[model samples]
Target: MATVVFVHAHPDDEASQTSGSMARAASEGHRVVLVVATNGDHGDVPDDLADGETVVHRRRAEAAASNAVIGTHHVAWLDYADSGMTGWAQNDHELSFTRADTEEAAQKLAAILREEGADVVVGYDWHGGYGHPDHVKVHAVTKRAAEIAGTRRYLESSMNRSAMIRSHQAAVAAGLDVGDWDPSAPMDDGNPLGSPEEELHWACDVSEFLEVKRSALKAHASQSDARGMLEMPEEWFAQGFSWEHYIEPGRPDGMVTGWFLGEETVG
Candidate 1:
């Protein structure tokens, strides 16, 4: 059983992006470790917090609940402050993950990777699925961390742009309400969502684990997006989130349907 370490930028990111894979890995008896780079201090502020409870504390508790739902074996936090969206003043904070020195942050994650004996280390794509500032930093730091730790396989978690567009078109054709979300529209850093289909390496079909994913998302109730996702139509959620995409750097272009272990389960 190989160990897979998923490095994320915030508390609920793993639930949104890689919870299925994490659940699958744990179910298969492979160790699953989650390393979050930030405390998520700048995420949505829930009004129901206890007297002295801060967003960071609440977010970390949410992450712990999420990890339980996903069957994650271990979790680590870099404890950096959240760097709010691109232009937000939080980005300039000395302790923000976005403003952290790349090498230093990488070292922190590399230590976790080494300790976990990670065979496969997962991170976000270059634009971090929507170009969020901390997410982009996660990409950079994870890349450097993987190199520093000499991990055997490095996979980048990402959405499949063409696949998303196809899913959206199908939804529209079926008269489903997709709201204002446009896959081709500019995101946080003026980049379209995720990488092109051709750029992806594999599509892990986690359809069977959809319930597990939803439960994990539900654990992060403090985040507005997570709450919104839980309220989305079940069919829509199944259609868009059943398959998680990834890019294995240096791999050839064509996409394959399989798990991250390089085993081809389906064509």
Candidate 2:
């Protein structure tokens, strides 16, 4: 069995993006490690968290609980903070992940890869899975770290350019707000706000992991709202949904999919 490391920008990202793959890998007897880059303190703050420290602690607990459901380990805060959404005006926060030194972040991720002897490293696509600054940083650092660690790197994207239009059209035809969104906007380019099929790299059938994903998502109660629920279809929730699609970076040419055993490294 090989070791796989998933580097993410925040707490809920694993659940929202790749929990199914992680769970699948673990169940298959491969070691899976989740390296979250931020403290996720910027996530929805509860009214009860009058103390900033308390908020961080609470979010950490929530993250831990969420990871438990998937049977994976969690790590975080190597040195950056969540960079919130783009153009949110708060993007320039002093502690934002965007501002973190790239080398520093890369080194932290490299350490995890080395320690875990990771055979494969997974991160976000160029758009950072929705273009969140932190997610973008995670992608950048994961690429660098995989090189530093001498491991294969995978980029997780939602859909390809073609599929994006198709999914959007379908959603729009279904009366969803597909047109009201613009992923190409400077602040929103990374996050298209709706499903785009072209963005997908390799779709994993995670129908079984959907409940686990929902449970983990629900763990962050402050962040879970009606809109978030509406964003997901009840059928998807019930029948399970495809959770992750990944793009392998450094491949010579053409698209490839499946569990990477790190054969490329054995020169």
Candidate 3:
């Protein structure tokens, strides 16, 4: 079976973006490896930490639980500190993933790709979905790593912006209490959320694994970000996350419905 490695910026990212793909890969008997660039030290601090336990430690534990829930065969951490959003002071931290040397980090991830013999590698979109500094760094680092390892199939994990807008409008029309967040609104680095519809290339239907994804999200219960998602009902979660989106750089824009190591068709 071919190996597929997913490179993510922080803990819990797999749950939000690529857990479905990972699950699909494992279910189909392909090896799935997840490499997280940072320990997520900058996420919302939970008040329930045990004495002397740090956020990094808790996040790592959560990641481990998430890995189990998603059936990931293995996981590796780059262990860099989280570089908080666009302008946060943590971005300047010496050990922050965002500030790490690109080549150095790429070399590290390349080693993993080489060791895993990855047939496909997945990273973040150009602006990292919402332009978070660490996420942007992940995109660059993973791209270079794939090049260094000579892996030709590299996909960028992203959201379908037009789909998000449609979902938002549907919620509104149904008198649902939609939050203020808008797909077209300026986010992290002043970029609108997700890649536009025409820019996307693949859509992996993970509706069957919605329960698995939700369980993975719940594994990260300590974080406020995950807590919000956990609060979402199963139907709402399915409505929003049933299909995970991706982009194969330099490929044509038609959306393909398929998994990591399977036949695909333009939809």
- Give the whole-model CA lDDT for all candidates, comma-separated: 0.91, 0.67, 0.89
Per-residue lDDT of 54-134 in model 1, one digit per residue for the tens?
A: 998899999999999899999899999999998999989999999899999999999999999888899999999999999
**lDDT, candidate 2, 1-267, per-residue tens:** 777888878777777677787877777777888888887766777777654456568777777887888878545446466677777655788777888888887988898888888877887777675567777787788888888878755555444444445555676789876545444433456345323443344555666677777777777666654228536668635433454566665455443454443344321
Worst 10 residues of 1 by lDDT: 258-267
Kindly give the number of clashing pairs for every candidate. Answer: 0, 20, 0
Q: Per-residue lDDT of 1-267 in model 3, one digit per residue for the tens?
A: 778899999899999888888898889888999999999988878889999999999999999999999999999999899999888899899999999999999999999999998888999999999999999999999999999999869999999999989988888899998778788899999999989888888887998888888899999998878889878886888888899999998777688776646745211
Q: Compare the candidates by lDDT and give the number of the best one.
A: 1
Q: After superposition, how far is residue 196 of candidate 2 from its true place, in Å?
A: 7.0
User: Each model's TM-score, in the order given?
Assistant: 0.96, 0.81, 0.95
Off by over 4 Å in 2: 50-53, 160-164, 174-187, 190-201, 225-227, 236-240, 252-267
- lDDT of model number 3: 0.89
